[model samples]
Target: MARIKETFDSRAWFMLECDDPDCERRFDDGQWYAYEDDLLADAKDDGWQILYRDEHPELERDMQYCPAHRLPECSTCTNIMADPAGWKDGQCPECIKEEIPNERS
Candidate 1:
């Protein structure tokens, strides 16, 4: 196939692009999948980076990423870092010392 329904978790469906220059596959598994937070967590676990892209405003899917890349943004505070070292364990330094926000938020 052309398309198949897949999920990072069994719940929500998250689309991820293959960052490999030769690959660059855009995943469009459809929205029937649920539990996006789980997918986000799974992406972090897999060392994927979430990058902001408006290339497809017509599709309304601005946030996209490559599984091979990792942006140093705090998943909790949503603050992006100039230095990738600023993030630790999927969080900013301050967030590492603080509690994780609601997963569903």
Candidate 2:
């Protein structure tokens, strides 16, 4: 697949593909992922691996499972607020600390 590199509203974006060979979903917008914070970092921490293009570091993007592949629930809280790519050991950091934000804004 071609590397994705684009900007919208002054924000830079890279392309993301699903790891599942059967579900090679691609996403250019970060919002669709619905990460708790720091999309890349959070995704990585949650066990999602990123694919890097050394030749195009600016376009280095991570591989993530689409919502259809994500598990719903905070492993620790047993709450349906966990993001498969943003949780660790089946638990979310926010839920572990009991500090999940109330709103996105």
Candidate 3:
């Protein structure tokens, strides 16, 4: 499951963070606006199970992570979302590849 950290900026816009210990992706205007309406819905639809939701009063945002999506139980596989190998430049290379499939035959 992937953990999402939600915080409010000065303008009251929702700021999101991928809270996986190894993941450094943060969601601000670009991600927020694009998935504002379907963030949770899409997550749910993708078979991601929410482990828990926490409210950070000091941060002024709700933080939630889906262990099912970010962290899997496979012994041979590491958390892809975390990108522990540093192969991704703050972006998951595997995820990017999955998003844009290669058309080459």
Candidate 4:
């Protein structure tokens, strides 16, 4: 969970943090907003990314990643991997391994 959502005095307060476990970047508007869209706009203005699901374009992503670690998700399995070497033909190593035949047939 990169963003913290809190309600105070009938208003919303947001504090964003980098999703990467190694990165320690954070953002706080320090002001209450009337609507979620307002806070989201501010978050984007500050370079925070709002990732979405590749398979389901209508569904918004639950997790947020910083500019540095905004890795691509595997097409077969929606997993965000840091190492590019794990990707081949837009699929992760594990997914590719699963496709391989167990025995030479």
Candidate 5:
């Protein structure tokens, strides 16, 4: 976590620290296991931002990095209404926890 911490609504917010977007592994010998790792990696690359907290000469040593605010759900889950009777689009911890297990390619 960064010193200047803030919360936002985005699916990425639910991600745990150890989760990786570029991991390669096999599961049940079924479909290729890539969606999760890929999504995470892409999000990190696309969302991360670099900033300098100091002025002039001190800028380089006082750099900070953070992620861009993203929607609470991925493109597919963003449309919570898609499953009106099933999942509710809360974007909170509860909602995120439930959705975490269902991410797939």
Candidate 6:
């Protein structure tokens, strides 16, 4: 099946699928799914299907590794860059460290 609702974390540069009810209405399941392809395999083993893999076309333009976002926490951080120049792009060294909304101008 096609994805239900997907969103850009707006910084980390991955497409988040909002399909699973277990993911706290966000992509929480995928958040901890980093590099653990085994988890994905296990899901398949357990009879779960991968309906779709959501991703940003823009990010693939540079062929970078698109990681899952922290979701509801670190998605909008200005610092989720793949390059050392990430800081220059308004992102912090770690994308999880964004300024609070009220703290910003």
Candidate 2's displacement at residue 95, Å, is: 38
List, residue by residue over 1-105, the lDDT tens digit for candidate 2. Answer: 233456666665555556555876554444443332455665556555444445325443433455556535554555544235566655666664676543322
Go through the candidates in order and give each one's C-alpha lDDT: 0.52, 0.50, 0.40, 0.65, 0.34, 0.34
Ranking by TM-score: 4, 1, 2, 3, 6, 5
Is candidate 2 or 5 superior in lDDT? Answer: 2
Q: What is the lDDT of residue 51 in candidate 5?
A: 31
Best by lDDT: 4
How would you encode candidate 5's per-residue C-alpha lDDT over 1-105 as one tens digit per residue? 222222454333223231124323212223222344553344356553323233324343422222432223433444312122333334434445566543343
Clashes of 5: 5
TM-score of 4: 0.49
Q: List the residue pairs that clash in candidate 5.
A: 10-71, 10-72, 11-71, 11-72, 21-37
Instruction: Please give each candidate's TM-score.
Output: 0.32, 0.30, 0.29, 0.49, 0.16, 0.22
Candidate 6 lDDT by residue in tens digits, 1-105: 222233445322232343333443433345443333443454445444343223323242322111232212223453223334434233344542444442232
Candidate 2 wrongly placed segments (more than 4 Å): 1-4, 24-37, 51-105
Ranking by lDDT: 4, 1, 2, 3, 6, 5
> How would you encode candidate 1's per-residue C-alpha lDDT over 22-44 as one tens digit per residue?
65555433433355556555656
Clashes of each: 3, 1, 10, 0, 5, 3
Most TM-score-accurate candidate? 4
Error of 4 at 70 (Å): 1.8
Q: Per-residue lDDT for 5-105 in model 4, tens only? A: 78888677677667768777665545655666776677778777665467335445556666676667677676655555867777779877889422312
Query: What are the clashing pairs of model 3?
Result: 1-66, 1-67, 1-68, 1-69, 1-70, 1-71, 2-66, 2-70, 3-65, 4-64
Q: How much does candidate 6 score in TM-score?
A: 0.22
lDDT of 3 by residue, 7-89 (tens): 55532223344554565544333555334436656554655433332322333333344443364322222223322343343
Predicted structure 3: clash tally: 10
